[model samples]
Target: MSNLIRLIIGFALVGAAVALFIFGHWGWGLLAVFFSICLFVTYFYNENMLIAQWYLRKDNMDKAAVFLGRITNYETQLNRMQHGYFNLLIGLIESRTAPMKSEKYFKAALNLGLHMDHNIALAKLSLAGIAMAKRNKREAQMYLADAKKADKNKLLADQIKQMKDQLGMLDRQTQVRYSHR
Candidate 1:
């Protein structure tokens, strides 16, 4: 459902709740208020994305992908803030099968902007990994630096350290090739 429709439904429920209260149906008014809150929550969080995230937490990409795929047109279905997240989820799922292809999605996610610092760090880290895979050491280094900066809570500290180690290995590999030449 579109975010606008959900907002309208939420307002309608609020009206119903007000009506019930005025009619002395306190219990039904409370129920209507609860349902309205749920609708408002979905307006921001997006039901399909929430389900997909749940599956992702379980490391079930296939199921997660299915739920993500349900949002045929995310621009209409999701809130403005959720645009980045939707792309981020797609990128993560695609990375498992096609790491290179996922790069665009990651870029889109970054461009659209995410709400959380950790998610921003995750996207940058993923981009750094992609750059490393492509043997673009300079690009990888930049992304790693950005990822480190974005990871304000140290949530990706271990992964950032590991990536830096791998980048050092890249440096060694190049040195070895130069020595052989």
Candidate 2:
């Protein structure tokens, strides 16, 4: 359906360009050609990003990672693409046999200073998870607090709060166990 719509629109634009050229409207024809090219590039670029996002959402991290890896040189202007790459990396760490290696990518993203809310939140969340895994409660809490501050999404905030509570409970349990021992 989408392909058909695209084909119809492409033909229509080409027809308009041809009509303008036949009418001796060189400027209009050139403008139409430029517009068509712009539209074509924009469509594919957007489509690739959407595909990557879809794969990520479906938890098909390998496919998402492949698609996202195909996108290079366009990251400077495509914050979402960069975010998607980082997301794929995080997913791979979560589901793959390899140990989680996302800290470097997350730190690089943070260093990019993109200020994208989602990216910042994800980076912080990743760091928080790492901290919690290492039993660094203070650092974990700090990262979770920072993530909560960076995003106003209630879901993310709630998740951070939950993580904090879990960490607190774990800490208390560890202390109780150690003291009893």
Candidate 3:
């Protein structure tokens, strides 16, 4: 189901829990609370991620951030793989405005293990971009090398090429600056 429908159902379950408590059905109320909490947790864990990813795919940053922002208590509730994906999504979102912050999220996702070469490669590419932005040429080169290795399908070949060209241009610019000094 869609995230909106799941959110509505979750709210409804919370209301049911409260109604059961008011009607003196203590046991049922407790059960309702448990189920509601489970539903909420499940909703927080899965639905937002799916919806946010869809928005991200469409390059709708505002919509994607809105969905992703709905998820709470990331560190405690999410499992290892889920946490990785969560960090990856957050990293992607932050990459445009705060690349330094995005780099940390991407690294965390990588350390936690995405288990998908394509995702790992993408994260690596983001890291390379961040490194390049920071003028960390060595780090950027390392990340690019890692991304190249992980991109078995060559899906990111164009991106890799662009970054490589940019890196070369930056290197030449730095070389000229140093030589002039």
Best by lDDT: 1
Which candidate has the top score in TM-score? 1
In the range 133-177, model 1's lDDT, one tens digit per residue, is: 999999999999999999999999999999999999999999999
Supply candidate 1's per-residue lDDT for 170.
92
Candidate 3: what lDDT?
0.87
**Over the stretch 116-171, how does candidate 3's per-residue lDDT look in tens digits?**
89999999999999999999999999999999999999999999999999999999
Backbone clash numbers for all candidates listed: 0, 0, 0
Provide the RMSD of all predictions against the true structure, rounded to 1 decimal: 1.6, 7.4, 8.8
Q: After superposition, how far is residue 82 of candidate 2 from its true place, in Å?
A: 4.2
Stretches off by above 4 angstroms in model 2 are 1-48, 72-99
Range of the 10 consecutive residues with the lowest summed lDDT in candidate 3: 72-81
lDDT-wise, the better of 2 and 3 is 3
Ranking by lDDT: 1, 3, 2
Candidate 2 lDDT tens digits, 37-93: 756655444555567678877978778767666656445535454555454354444
Model 1 TM-score, all chains together:
0.92
